[model samples]
Target chain A: MSSYIALFGNPNTGKTSLFNNLTGSYEYVGNWSGVTVEKKVGILRQHGVPIVDLPGIYSLQPLSRDEGVATDFLLTEPCSAIVNIVDASQLRRNLHLTVQLLEFGKPLIVALNMVDVAEKRGVKVDAEKLSRCIGAPVVPVIARTGKGTKELVRAILSLSEQSGEREHVAIDYGQDVEAAVQKISEQLPDDLLASKRWLALQFLEGNERIHAYLQTYMDIAPLVAVRDEAQQALGRPLAEHIYDARDKWIVHAIETSTVIFQQKPLTLTEKIDAVVTNKYLGLPIFLTFMYIMFMLTFDWLGSPLADLLDQFFSGPLTEWLSKLLTLVGASPFIQALVLDGIVSGVGGVLVFVPQIFILFFFISLLEDSGYMARVAMVMDRFMEAIGLNGKAFIPMIIGFGCNVPGVMAARTIEQPKERLLTILLLPFMSCSARLPVYALFAGTFFAKNQAIVVFSLYVLGIVVALGLAKLFSSTLLKNESSIFVIELPPYRMPQALTLWRSTWDKGKGFVRKAGTFIFGGSVAIWLLTYVGPKGIGVSMDDSFLAVIGGVLAPILAPLGFGTWQAGASLITGFLAKEVVVSTMNIIYHAKDMDLLQGAITQHFTPLSALSFMVFVLLYIPCLATVATIRKEAGSRKWTLISIGCALTIAYTISFLIYEGGKLFGY
Target chain B: MVLTDLRQGQKAVITNLAITNEVVKQRLLHMGMHEGEKVCVKCVMPFGGPVMVEVDGQYICLRRKEAACIGVR
Candidate 1:
């Protein structure tokens, strides 16, 4: 029988960091709210008990999909204890959830995280006093540096050791509301998961989940009547009355245990925000940061390392591996499988790992430094004008790294219509996987302006995504977009370990995909290219891959890369975007990357190559992304809409580019 | 007046939330925007963007339209 303890907190309270410290597992920790969309489970190292990290939530009554997940988990999962983490600096606001958590009556330990940050602002929290007042052990811990983590773990172990019947603190809603709650509670089944009083409060507040639960066990009309009676007596929505009660309770708790010195002057975060989020300077500063990030990724760091790796893979690695295979008496077919299929296919994708890592590194830095939230704040108006909210920008930026998580990140957007629209347009943000295609083409065709060419493609993706978002909002998913109420957390230096872990987590996914999807895809493509309808070892032109590519070539003819090789690479790209580069690597038989670049220049004029890159940028997202769209959107209709819209947009844009170039006679 | 009427650096107490949408109301309440809580207008983004408000020691950025629904004095 394994006991479970859940780490719960408000957003950006360092719940994930504390979970990481206790469980020794690195889950993605961001400085903004809603970073952890799903709950993650890991075993505590000291107690060997499984600890779950729930998504950050404000209250038991969920306002968003991610918050609903946290609430749902607490309702369904049986846990021995809950380690409720709260930001000490925002103790009053954070305690709103803590007060609600106390209603569940589980063995609870309150980890007051970020105490040092609070102290810096001239706020002092008496932990022992807070512990006594809240009736839970309050441990001051800095989750980022792992300070007080051992004490936290010890508290949890001791909490589980005690009999789970702890004193539950209940807020006293006024007499009328209390009477209504008591009336509703008397009707609830004894075997219910949470306290009857909690359920009654939820019922009176018109919680949909609680209402539906009442419908199953008993006739909900009586409960509804009592709730209405209570509302009529209280002269307000039950939720409002309940909120007032909890607010008073939280204010009392804060006044008892916390002291504030004289108001501090504008802190570092405010000073930074004064400029970074200035109305006139905000967008420019954001754009400048983006430019710097891309410059660093492409020109300064990533591209050079990628080129070095490309040379190593094409020259020394291939030579040594081929020689070793020949010495082992491996047949020529086996040699091709090892050196060409596995090595070239996976290696071609791996060559871009440096660029991907650097891109993720900057993204993590932005997210962990708390700048990502401000980006959302600055971009909100622009996004709202285009029929979305500012928060949608966060996912779009994430889409630059990959569309799968970008689409999933839309869960943070409370509006269903806006979220769906965000998911549909996410593929237009040319992800890092598509970088290899751009790098290969831009480096070859537009060598003098490779950086500019790549930058233009990214800009093009955003423009198209926005255009389509506007179109969708006006037509298909039209609705009043939800209000934007995002928190701007104080800026802090990103912890090195957390930053490295996030970068590695994203980079590791790329490597794993390269190993499995790209490796298998490369072999399948190799077989198709090698074996003709007649037999094996046929000329490349007569191979089955050529036959298929020839069939698909006409569809792509207007985009200017209608050749069989382009068609085949685009087809393989469905597995993953990077496979397009690997497929081209295998088909052109350019073992030397320099020769490959030369071969590409000979085949594609700069204009046609640009058209092709644009096509790849807007075309159907990889299969994983499409599947994620289906899951996230929860409708085949919307998934097909996404795929259809992407394909149509890609073709239309590429066609215009290709024909428009021909008119210019470049 | 609604929260949007507040000038930069103006301080007021939230008098009421005029939002009709339940989700929006819940979200605001969860962020500690209950009536009687003190709110300070931190900054207003140009071009009618969000109004940044400091409440309960947290800086929250709300769109102008959303802010328009927040009654304050």
Candidate 2:
């Protein structure tokens, strides 16, 4: 069995970067907080010991779901030693968590990261003196460059070899707090003997999570009484009293060891923020950033790569397979299944890969450069109408490119309620996948003003998403007590290597999902179209796909596009939104877009065409999006709600559009 | 004075948090914001957006509703 080391720290303190350094692994690192939302394990190569990198948190008291992950690991997990990463530039605030870790009574080694940044800002720390003050070995490190990592690794191996138990640090608070600590310590159970002092301190500070954990082992009536009495004794909050005592001890340590040259604080960050967050310039700046990212991802870089991929699959790969089948004397049925069903089915899903990676690269850049926090702050005012803060806005914007990445990007939101709300509302963002359907319909129905029609659909998606968010946040998801607060980290230029690694990390999920879920969904749709009860390779009108479409067509009658051909196209659309157009092309026996558009004009009027597009816009999300939602949401319940909500809203809205058009004599 | 009442470049020492919710109070405390922490308003966004404040060399954004609960002077 291998011994394990627990890596912990305050959020955005370079904990993940240090973990990446020690373990020789590349996990995502972001400037803003809450980027690592789950615990990850990597091996220390030299020693082969497991290092568990827990989510970054300020203290044992969790403010959000990710913070709870760190706090739970601290209380429950057993480790040989604890590696606490403290940001050197923000020493005072980082030390607040370090103080709590000291009282945790584990063998501790503090990795003082970002020393170079601290030095440039005129802040210096004497590692040995600070170590003596905190009763731990402090290794000054720069995680970004792997500087001092060798010594840090050596210190970690030595720290783990030492005895795991140590005397917990007991700071002498004012008389009132100390009195209450003594009484609460007496009331703790025997099982919590070693941690009684720390538990009592946390209990007095109103850490409800710790209080509830203690409740299972002992009756907490007396502990509660002590806390109330202590709060009454101190005219101010008891936590402040405790903090003040720790600050006094820290001040002495800082005065003795640390030196400050009194340079202006964060001049670069302050200057950049002044203009980026200006009253008039903030929003326009953010919008410009978003537009640049979209253009790069969709037009400048990603589009050419995707087009090349499309040509390879349809032009070369399909022809090569056909030649091979002909030379081998294979049956025509086998040729159709191989070329049309498998080749085209899989290729269609693969075409989106470039866009996903390019979009993820830009997202990683935003998160790493520390501009994400500012984006949230700038958008919070507009998002307030939906009862959400600005963090929820990031995922929705990303959804405009692809919903799979959009759903995965919701992890940055700290609170679970906001994250879930963002995920549920993602389908209505009018992703690039739905654009083909809009192009086919809008080109035929509203040829004179194609841009306006497409833009109107995009605006409708946003308006409905916002309206539903406002409804759900106040009703079903109203339980969270979260406050709107954002921590603005200093902007740093993202390194090329880090940007690539994180982009790969995020983009890989979308690819894997496409490979498994989308692949299977395409095969299933193809199978239904290829065979019917009448016989194998029967016409699609008499096939099982058509039967299913007929079942759905009646329900869609009120929405004005009630034919089985419309229904069949929608059934295949579930596999991927792009498949709907292809399915219509095949079922309607139209070999090209002009033929399809000519045929569609004969089957429906302009009003029905618009309603059909609306139905496609708000119907259930594609299968890959559903699968990603299930994995990210972590519950079967929310995934169903997302699907059901989309289906219901799509139906109601499309029906209104079609019927109201008739009532107004359109 | 409440925190939101401070203009740009105005500094204030946090006095008492007039919040009834204990969890929100704990969050504020854990951010190194307590009774005596000095904070300077870096910028106040228009249309009642979040106000960016610099405290102890750290910048944080606090919305108007939560900022108003911070008793400062």
lDDT of 1 by residue, A1-666 (tens): 455798889988999989999999988889899898888899999678999998888887777778778888867788888899999888888998898788777888999998888888878899999998888999999998999999888888888889557876778888998898788888888887787887888777667866766687887888888988888888877777787788788888889999998567448888898899987999999999999888878788878999999999988999999999989999999998877677868887899899899999999999999999999999988888889989999999888888988887888888888888889889999898999999889888887788888999999999999999998889877757556779888898887877898999989999999988888998999899999999999989999999999998998888888889999999889888999998888887777568778777776888889999998898898999999999989999999988898899899999999999999897
User: What TM-score fits each model?
Assistant: 0.97, 0.87
Error of 2 at A56 (Å): 1.8
Please identify model 2 stretches exceeding 4 Å from their true place: A1-3, A167-169, A174-183, A192-194, A229-236, A296-304, A326-331, A395-424, A430-458, A473-482, A557-569, A572-613, A621-642, A656-666, B71-73
Local error of candidate 2 at residue A237 (angstroms): 3.4
Clashes per candidate, residues 3 or more apart or on different chains: 1, 0
Task: Give the docking tier of candidate 1.
Answer: medium
- Clashing pairs for model 1 are A380-A390
Candidate 1 is scored at a TM of 0.97
What's model 1's lDDT at A515? 86
TM-score of chain A of each: 0.97, 0.86
Query: What C-alpha lDDT do the candidate models reach, one value each?
Result: 0.87, 0.80
Which prediction has the highest DockQ against the true structure? 1
Report DockQ per prediction, comma-separated: 0.75, 0.73
* RMSD in Å for all candidates: 1.6, 3.9
